[model samples]
Target: MGKGGSSKDTYNIAHQKGTPGAGGNRGDRLIKEMIHDPYKTRSKLPEPTVCPECQALFQQGRWAWAEVPPNANQELCPACQRIRDRAPAGFLMLSGAFFQEHREEIINLIRNKEKSEKAQHPLKRIMDIEEQEGETVVTFTEIHLPRGVGEALNRAYEGELDYQYTDETSILRVRWHR
Candidate 1:
């Protein structure tokens, strides 16, 4: 809350005496911006550049695969930038007894899924994968990739898949377990 009138103070002056009116549904009053994905590149990126890291071509208003033009503008794509910054926007949590037993297979599947998506959409990328003591977490540069991974795992392994989009931060979290 801000300093002056920002407090969440409620007043009931209308219903001071007698009968109460019907309660109307408060729709947007308390709703926060529920964002599934937030992009960091707000400013216009450098034009028609080639990302040496991913070998992706940034041309014709978006990323694509093209032969490096003569003196092609070279710059890092958003995905590579996210990886370099280590600031992931998507999170996938893989855990459960079943996950422990099939760690390698599941991890391979996730990697393959990411690879396929990355081929089509250069912005979709896996930032990091961490194997913790009991759980494995996969971080992504884009929201759709993690959800895609969770969906792929669910399709392949018939696991329990849960997804949530945060209201404030707009971060996407996905949990897959058997």
Candidate 2:
């Protein structure tokens, strides 16, 4: 009933003509098939070079490059990859008098602990130690805390601790109070 073609015409073309190699085994069907064979030889296509982390392919058509290749590092893209790769997986947020009093001690303890533990697990890294106004924030990545790390922290410093978990990562947010 439409201007292009009727339903009956489509049905007739779909079935009546008996398309070449139709009514064949479904298991052996080609993944990508064209109306006519485009390739002269029957061979698998070559795989494109892809980033192992993000699985992004390097295509000549899509991207323009002038000798200096971009995103040479596997960690992240040139601009954002460094920040994301270096960003801490976990953070400790502290505010008020507690931060001012125990900032150095807390940082030293965490750094020492991290250094000792990193020998066993090299993937664990400390990203940053920052103090802003009355707040102190420590950021770390790939840190695996023991069972008593939380309880000991609470006992030593008066603060609230928050934690978040995702499929691939976990974030710890700690708030210290006087």
Candidate 3:
């Protein structure tokens, strides 16, 4: 309400001191850290690319189950690449007495979940399922699948579900017990 009746200068002067520059971060603000997945492609794959391993097609900026057109570009999709490297982005651990008694039923559920997820998302896949001494470990090619599977298990069977995610990478660990 002074000379020019403008508060812009006052606001600018107040905020100018600690404002981030062109680089964006001033090291003071709590910027949300980005989780990186090495298996993910930084850039878009060329349209019509086909994964040689799984025969998944990369079209319209996504991978999906589709027939390969003649002379389609051949490249390993991220999921197949992760499988080949034996590096999984998600892990689901199942344990407890209830799981032991219902092992077959639980395994079927897990497989069913994977099948449904894979039908929609070609990248989301189960890498491996291992039965250890007292627990079962299922690994996934992508992080989202494990979380989805764990939630499905929790919903269907009413078990204890927990999730662990890291700050540096796109990985998830899910634990389920009944």
TM-scores for every predicted model: 0.75, 0.43, 0.83
lDDT of each: 0.80, 0.48, 0.88
Ranked by TM-score from best down, the candidates are 3, 1, 2
Model 3 spans > 4 angstroms off: 1-12, 15-33
Best by TM-score: 3
Q: Could you give candidate 2's per-residue lDDT for residues 1-178 as a string of tens digits? A: 8885998876555554334334542333456533321111133222333334433333442211223335432322221232365655456665656656776776676677767655544334466777766577666554344212334466777476555544243345555455
The predictions' CA RMSDs to the true structure, in order, are 8.3, 16.6, 4.3
TM-score between model 1 and native: 0.75
lDDT against true structure, model 2: 0.48
Model 2 stretches with alpha carbons more than 4 Å out: 1-84, 143-151, 166-170
Candidate 2's displacement at residue 43, Å, is: 26
Between 2 and 3, whose TM-score is larger?
Answer: 3
Clash list (residue pairs), candidate 3? none
